[model samples]
Target: MTLGLDEEHRELGASLRAWAAGLDGPAAVRAAEGDPAETFEKVRAAAAGMGLAGLALPASAGGDDGSPLDVAVALEACAHALLPGPLLGPAVSELLLAGGHPGSDAVVGLAPGAPDLVWDAPSATHLLLPAPGEDDTWVLVEAAAVDVEPVVALDLSRRFGRVRAPWSGGVAVTGLTRARVRRTTVAMAAAEASGVARWCLETATSYAGVREQFGKPIGSFQAVKHLCAEMLETAEAVTAAAWDAAVALAADEEQAAFAADVAGAVALDGAVRVAQTCIQVLGGIGFTFEHDAHLYLRRATTLRALLGGGDVWAASLAARAASGVRRRVEVDLGGRDAGVRDEFRTRVAEVAALPEDARRAALVERGYLTPHWPAPYGLGADPVTQLVVDEELVRAGIGRPDLKIGGWAAPTVLEHGTDAQRERFVRPTLTGEIGWCQLFSEPGAGSDLASLRTRAVRDEAAGGWRLTGQKVWTSLAHEADWAICLARTDPDAPRHRGITYFLVDMGSPGIEIRPLRELTGDAMFNEVFLDDVLVPDDCVVGQPGDGWRLARTTLANERVAMASSRLGVSTERAVALAGDATPAEQVRVGHAVALATVCTLLGVRTTLRSLAGHGPGAESSVAKLLGVRSRQDASELVVELLGERVVLEADDPQVAADVHEMLMTRCLSIAGGTTQVLRTVAAERILGLPR
Candidate 1:
């Protein structure tokens, strides 16, 4: 199941956002709190005015005549702003109407205390209650028929009224069946839970970035950072699961049930964890009545139990899965192909066989090498196949082969390179005969790559061009055979339009390479001074002024590459680390491990999307940020578990390695993209914030 907003869906989001942005904002939500009637009316009016009432309504009804996916879209936007009863009412009613039930003047009653609750019983036209069995079947009742008695709720923006209905007009859409209703309601519940989880994360994260303590934003501290990161991840998992379920519901019934089950369990878990961690991150104020964090927490606890809890879903899924038990199957790879499980034996064999460079040669011979390169370049594996290759490599304890030149530089050439250019560079990249480095980043231009100063002047005398400038952070230039350089080929045009991508040989005269010392004391990056480095005209990639667009194909893929962690560990590490530690230490370790596994899965899920042409988008940035946070948490767990030894040199190899890894983890945030940069990227690109 796929989850994303296409162009039209995005347009719908913008419209809804603009409408909601005009409402009272937090001030309105705050004002309406406690005054159930006033708040419900205000929120309800706003929601109805925006067509939330008819979002999933069929054309036969007085509705937008849309799909359930459309309803999911509207619900997500409403969830983002913490919109109150108004949006919830229509959404619930629309669901009822979509299911062919009589839903007018009906309100949806979510399980009590659902965080991000849009359910306000007093204002709902009908209320939907969960009745669990093989599928989620809800008992719907008219608001008038409900013997609703108002109950005080933690969140003032929403109010709950206990409802009892024993009436016939509360008709079940006969053909829809109990199982189908259960699936839909569970999916909706999961979606709403995700929305709440996200809100908590966004709230805590924004606060962390600004709320200074001890002369620094608390977010700078590893403790606060880890908590916020966990919150973000919890939110992400819920969102991913919910969307997966929603899309599945739209596409297939059985998958929808599985998706719903997964969503319900994960969303409930995520909502609760995110809310609790957010409260901890916010400290004292987060616990106060004046703060909104508690409301979300209360809602999370209530809603998690409202649907069949996580244990119930887990049991259900487990029971179903166990019934499918079959013996493990094996296939012939002819000592050529390897499955994920073959890693241990494969690694032992690879290490034993390697006398010197035979291992590299074997990798190339076996087709596992350069799996990321397009077909003609080598293994010809697509991203999905590449992921499988990566997992096998990591499991086998194999290090990533040095291929900055071929793996990174050749893809763009294959996509846009002239036939001559591809013939010259492609095969060599796979064979590892030629090494490459990128020369795009500069002091003045980082994210803004097109605003570069490097120039490639026409050198008709040599039937090529002469380039002269400095390029910073050029990895592998010291050993590079060539560099794929982006330079100003038509300086008179607009910044983005004037650039050209060129292939520059490192052996060219006047090109000098110098390694830049890093905090880690590794000179992995270099600054290259290109002084009249000549490049033949045949080396020009694509057209003269299409470099900016071509560069994206390379740069965007870099995020997915970096996200592919070679140091693959598991939840077991986190669990074992804290078992013998103090209480605080155990919680820290447990949280980190669970968080890491969750984040790793999220990374895989998002990578799948990016490979599908969704681009990295905001979702990728969120994953990257979460990855950095997970690394930090893992580092802290190691440090705390080791106690005094981390602060002092250790004689034990394992202890020494732990300390080294802790220090290395510091660079996690600084690499791929900084946490700070990714946050702004999320705000601008994902959240639709202004520049």
Candidate 2:
């Protein structure tokens, strides 16, 4: 959900987006790089006239008070457009204001002499340059104390200057502290890096979409899509880290420092990766002086050094995080020990050694498999342990042997099954017994699964129920021993309350299962027809109309399953890919580290929110959006790096295997809830935007 925006900040972002979409943009920025006087004048005018420089500064400092989130939105827009200027200047100003400085005419300072750098010195009516010194006291030099010399910049639109200022300008504003300023500077650098990184990803993606190679959009190539995907991932992670810093700043100073350190390290690494990957996407042209790619790289380099570099920040954070913090705290048992650590390795290897038939048997014998299954529930395994068992199996690369609805159905039966029903049905499920499939979805029912029309009627003489209806997407039904059916058993009741969950024997007369193949080339989904099938009264689960609530538990488990799975590739594989790239591409591998760092930041944010008792919210949507975009970015980059060999789709076997990912990348935004849907969700939930 878009968080409700303050009208002014919302307008500011909209204006920036509108403005950046126009003109030659990066070309203009590139052209101005050589002419500092012209570029500075243009950027300073845009920033000041747009009122972007002091957005978050308090009103006491001749500024309209705003917040960091506001500035983030504005900067995100600027980054989206690849605009050059002080997107972080406002954030810096906010820090200054918070520190009790009311330099009504204060201007922020940066490392004074990088010609190609577009450092923050917006045409402030009163420039404040903090001179380098041994003492904690800041010597703020006025505009006149500064002598600006122009330098040729890679991005002409953003010229850099050499500033020579006196040791002191004006008295320090009350409340400004050296410690606060230092921390704020580091955080602002991270924010700037985030802006540049995102721009690189979006810019590269735009180019890939229109730039044709091999008679198709370059994005069609798996290598290209993956490169773009990776870029998106890097950008996303950086954004999250930066935002986490902002949130921490909002909450507490110490947390702010920690967050900023993490953000600075991650964003620095991400910026370099994004710049290099974008250049790769642009091919040979990206390396030339004529292109704007180098300009961004230059900025990334300058920023990386400006904020103490990644190593320094990372080391600092490591030291701080280790000090008195719970380094080995106990975690929730469900997802623990699934990594390739010692215990994880042993269990997986043991499971992997078992043959198909023996694996299930071994699992039953060893008490590792369905640890939660009720005695009548089929197999008696603890739920938490069962979750860990599945996790271990997946970690070991052991495919879950096909178990139809029986996997889900037996649990319902055991939970609410009769003694006779459990004796007859649950035993076979534990032995190399029959499988079961869920017959829940229908031609009209999907996300709205309760609107099912499958009917089951009482048959007094047969002492059972007769079912007649069709169920679509019944995975693995053809070889199932039973079907977990949800039907409209009480039509007069509320839609949700009217349904009943039942276990139907697959061998019953008039039941049919037809397989349907999915994008993965697997016959895992099917359509099932139940015609006059008889299910005894003992097969019904729970009370007659409580199926909806019971079904919710199963659906919730599905989500939990998805959330706990290994969501990305191994670090070893990523390192190998990085090793294969050129020296420049090795710099791109830093992007992988940046991505992982950002993922951690996202986890932190999610944890914080969850602690506050809220759902993942817009942050989750942002994470998802960023994930798909990053995957596409990485895909594109790989293809570009792979070069001519990318043309043979699935032809070389190795590269060809990636063809599926290439195809899948196109649908990344559309799956797991489309990016558009998520964007709307973010707008409503996070931004609190109007419908």
Candidate 3:
């Protein structure tokens, strides 16, 4: 999201990508496959010539002492070009030494577990691992003292071999902990994965732009467009995950472990998906050995497997989070936004300092309650201003009361209602003095919301209209003071053209509300019946037959309000619940953690786009699609983590809550729009697909 990415970093990445192109790209990668030694020397010499060997090493050690993020950017670029050589292990070794492990000039390699094959062992002067029969200590053995037997590897881009080292004569190293080593390795691997994913995205997109089918570029097809869009999303997610790891490691932040686990958990899987999809985009050529797509897929798969795959890391993420670990992604609002943000922060602080009971009124008086609205009612904030206000509010531990339906309703009214209507409703709605609910969806109409059967007959004789309709899934209807309604004003008109927008009083005659119990055993949703309810003409929001249009606006508002930078909330709780989780449950928990992190990354990318002057864009739609999946998946994991405890004792408090949350997630996919419906939206609307 460009949180701390500078021009220098951008140039560094570009330079590396270009440099890798000049070195050996995918063609070289394929040739070096199964036998890296033949082609390794040339790239090694080139890297050393560019001083890449000591990039992560301290300046005092004749190195650049580059930040972890800097190293990550470089790796991502290198991997994007499929640049070969034993890069990862040596860089990691340099980082370890900087952290006080003893090593110099010698290439260093690492082995993860007991009696493991160490990649790049042939080129290493030393190897590091936990010492045998030693407590909290590590051993560094000379390469000559180790037996290296070359073995075939899935990713032929790098070399690997079995290593049997003499630990008895090894140098004992202090302060190089297992936890630290694992964190660094996982983080760096994710960084490399990010590069692979980026290359897949770029290559596939570039191909789509040129490849033609049925008289047009393949990119013009909805299927291809959607594929590319998803690829873009995965690319961003991979980068975000890797960036989190690199940032945490370089800063030695509190979330170093948490961030690294999430990166390893999500990046590997995302990279694999992206690479495979890239092949699909390339069609027949992608399957042939002549194409480079398989090479990337191999490398991505190997890297994922090298670190015990996404499942292992995901489980680790859940275990860590369950232990009260949290990861937060912070953005640096550069230049003008930074100064503007500080100014708003102080004002927000002043309002926040008030007693809890009095805070709402203060916020309203300052026009911060609905900053996106026009002046007097609000500041009419632009995207940047809106985000600044949002950031400040979250920081001050202050929350603005959600105006419920009024959020969209009031905006709809202001945009279309007469001054008298505005004076009667907008102010109170913004201040929370009036509560609003929506009556748009009917049992027969959900995603096809325009097909609703509610009736609103005009009564010119009286100054109002008689309304009769049934609204399903009407949340807050039982508690609402007012409702923004949709009813068919003219059944003779077309399906979408006949609906009209109206505001109905909850206390009106013939209005009945029955609670609809859900799988959670909670009646948060209700079925509202309006039998001949009277609605004054003044209560109408817009011209008759405008319900569908206004309802769409309200629906959009709902989606935006529901969007968030959090998905791991439940997973974190589930982690705590599954402290002694079984291996299977641990893997499930890990999957949830990874999903949550990716959801967050997606949201960050969206906000970044908005802040960059792009209005919402494709992510707004894409997020809903993925977010529904994340929420539902995480909820299911919570229940699965509980295992038989949930089934045996359905009434247990914790068990019940987890079950309820899981059941509640069912609505996510069906609510604003079904997953199928959203995908089509992305394909046709965003991706330019045929209907």
Candidate 4:
């Protein structure tokens, strides 16, 4: 889905898409490639007439007076068609002219340097050239003064011409007007990338669904389906990144710089990757000149090269993050939250004013602790309400104790447990009086949890059930007061069936906990031995032989929190470590920043889906899959940036921490769900591939 796009943007994109579809974009691009000077004066004139050249310019200056975001929407639609034109360059020039340049009606071509690879240079009346040694400052040169040289580029759909020295008619643009031009250029470029990725995704998916192989559609094949799924994730990321960049630039927020860099870091890569994957999914036909896939690929790659690649932008983003730059998402409460925000904020403030020790109790009592939970236990808070409460609490300097295992356990208990079970466990868990741990994973049953061998036999004499099993990788077992566990209850039943879900007191006799040191040199995880551990009938979370279904609740909770929370770890670490980074290092840090931003956007989309009464669909799984990769990559970058100090020294605390964090991040992929397993699931379940 396109992130944060309103109806106007959607219609704008649709209208352009329709217009380009009728023009046969591929044929036009092919025509342009064959003869660079064959000047489609009519086609360029058509785009200009449609206001493509002046979308962001003011009506006073004879233009649409659109915002940066509106121009971005138009560019994306244009990119979908691989439509050949001087749209981006002209948009830059018009925005410059609207910023108070004298020649508002002149056709302008924008080039970063000495007019090398500049669009429409031979055709334009003027060229907008950046000043040699100044940042965000440019010189407007009349086209007739600079001799133009035509050349072929990787993207055959677009024409390019170069212009060099000894040119007069130079007018300088500095200050705010120059800065706006720079940022808007980056934002529009990102939007173009986003459009390219979107087109690739739609083309590949549509092709895969119809293209047959071995008597079935290729989309039915796991490999093709997974590739398409990856393209979907990339496309979504590009959209989110581009949209944020556009919004930030238009709003002129402090986040504009980092947002622009993030867009640069993510959008260009996504465009290229998605385009390449589109070709892969389409197979041999994708590689042929007859197909339009190569055109988009060329455009994606060329744009990336021109922007100096994702690494360059990523490194700058990292430095800003290090300097404490944050992209605070500006949300307009609008009519949706306006009615409830004040009352909710006021009540939240009242509870927050209480003593720190008493705040948790008050929050639980007033249903502010877990707003998403049902009434009597929580406020049954919708997404909007929850956000309001979060904002209010953060404002008041109040905090709630994280119910780690309780987040999953309490939800399971609320959904499947009895009234008595809910009364006894829910409040205490939410109030921070009781801590919980999960004993669901073992050596053999982590991802394949159905394969658990731990047995739970009914014991009549003790008047309960006895659980005997070895549960490994149980975090907080050394400190938790209780645990929600899964054990096999029926030997005759299928692997997925015959298991039961139970809550056991950690203090129960015959329970043994052994700390397991990790690669990070920490022992937060432990091996628990449950030899003759007794759990009463009331402790059964649901009916016997229902563990598999109940386990899904726990996993669902894990998936919800997966990308959102883990995203901060590497980002915070990267920010802490990135101090005045070199260009190369900035690229790496920028990559991390972009990934972090995407992770946040994914969460926002998931939340929007939840609020809309739709399941997060496959994107939720995609988030976890991509998140693990991002965090691991980011973690490795940290160590790589440290040179050889990481390998040579453990005495330095900072070095030691970096080393430990680097090693610990390895588990990111292995834990929750292995990257390989999740990809397969996304292919089969999300992308609708054959098992």
Backbone steric clashes in candidate 4, count: 4
Model 4 TM-score?
A: 0.86
Which stretches of model 2 miss by more than 4 angstroms?
1-12, 85-91, 97-107, 111-134, 146-166, 173-178, 325-597, 600-691
* lDDT of residue 361 for candidate 4: 90
- Which structure is stronger by lDDT: 1 or 2? 1
For candidate 2, write residues 1-691 as lDDT tens digits.
1111334544666777787666445765665546544665565557566676567767766666767666666666665566664445435655555444444345554432232222455343233344345345443445455665544444333434455533345655555555566566655555556767766776687787778876887765656766666666566667667665655556566666666666766777788899999999889888897776777787777666655566666555544443421111111443433452466458668867877657766665554445455442223433334445556677777655444456666556565667777777765776647677788888888646768899888788998778889998776677777778888877888888888888887888888788887675767678888898888888887877888877755422221221221224322233345545665554444443344345545544454444333555434545676666656655555555566766855478656545445545665776434565555444333433333
Q: Write the per-residue lDDT of candidate 4 for residues 194-274, one digit (tens) a residue.
A: 888978888887888778888998887767877877787788788878887887875555578878888888888889999
lDDT of 1 by residue, 502-562 (tens): 9988888898888998655678789999898888889988888898888877522333432
CA lDDT of each prediction against the hidden true structure: 0.64, 0.59, 0.77, 0.77
TM-score of each: 0.57, 0.52, 0.79, 0.86
What is the Å distance of residue 392 in model 3 from its true position? Answer: 6.4
Best by lDDT: 4
lDDT of 3 by residue, 1-691 (tens): 2222455776788888888888757777766764567677678778888778778877677778788887788788778888777788887777766744343355777775444678677677787766766666777887777777766678868877685544456877767777787788877888888889878877887788778888898876767877877876676667777877887885554578888888887888889999999999999999998888898999899888877777878778777766666666665556557668778989999988888999898888777777777767777776567767777787898888978778878888877889998889989997777898888889999788778898988888888999998999988998999998889999999888988889899999999999999877889899999998999998987888877777766312122121243455567766776777787787778777776776776666566555555556554566676677788888887777677988898888878877888898899988877776666566556545444
Q: What is the lDDT of residue 293 in candidate 4?
A: 94
